[model samples]
Target: MISGLVQILLFQSLGELVSKFLLPTLPGPVIGLVLLVLWLVLRKGINPDLAMVADGFSQYLGLLFVPAAVGVVLFLPQLQANALAIISALVGSVILTIASSAFIARLLSKRESHE
Candidate 1:
């Protein structure tokens, strides 16, 4: 467990350095995650220790949202003031998501039929 955590932190620190020096646009953690994914893909499998650590983290993933929820609560007044715009944006995003998914599925089916 300690080893896995160390491995994760190592990647995160490496990612931070890369982000600071090379990729100014991306967040350190996201770059770290991309690096981790590439590493896993190259290895062709998840390390057992890493997998175990990830499983433990996944179980408590909901806890990660607490901060965001707190932010929403903190800005409740602003949210309420802009409720209409927020609702419209939410609805628009859902509609766009559904439309894009359908378009992609149709394109995939057409490609499969052609093949």
Candidate 2:
């Protein structure tokens, strides 16, 4: 477990270094995740220890939203101030998402029928 955690952190740190030097725009954690994915793909399977560590982390995944909840609370006033715009965007995005998803599904169904 400890070794798995270390491996994860090592990749994250490497990603941070890459982010600092090579790609200043992309986030360090994202880069680190990509690196980790590539490594796992090349290795052809996950290490047992890493799988265990990931399972443990997954169990507490809901806890990760705490910070986001706190952030929303902290910016409550600002959010309230822009509620109109926020609501508008939310509704518009929902409509667009549904429309696009339906279109894609329809196209896929048609293609499948043809084949």
lDDT of 1 at 97: 100
lDDT of 2 by residue, 1-115 (tens): 9889998998999899999999999999999999999999999999988999989999999999999999999999999999999999999999999999999999999999999
Model 1 clashing-pair count: 0
Q: Highest TM-score, which number?
A: 1
Please write out the lDDT profile of model 1 over residues 1-115, one tens digit for every residue: 8888887998899889899999978999999988988998999998888988999999999999999999999999999999999999999999999999999999999999999
TM-score for each candidate, following the candidate numbering: 0.86, 0.78
The clash count for each model shown is 0, 0
**Cα TM-score of candidate 2:** 0.78
**Which 10 consecutive residues of model 2 have the lowest summed lDDT?**
2-11
lDDT of each: 0.93, 0.96
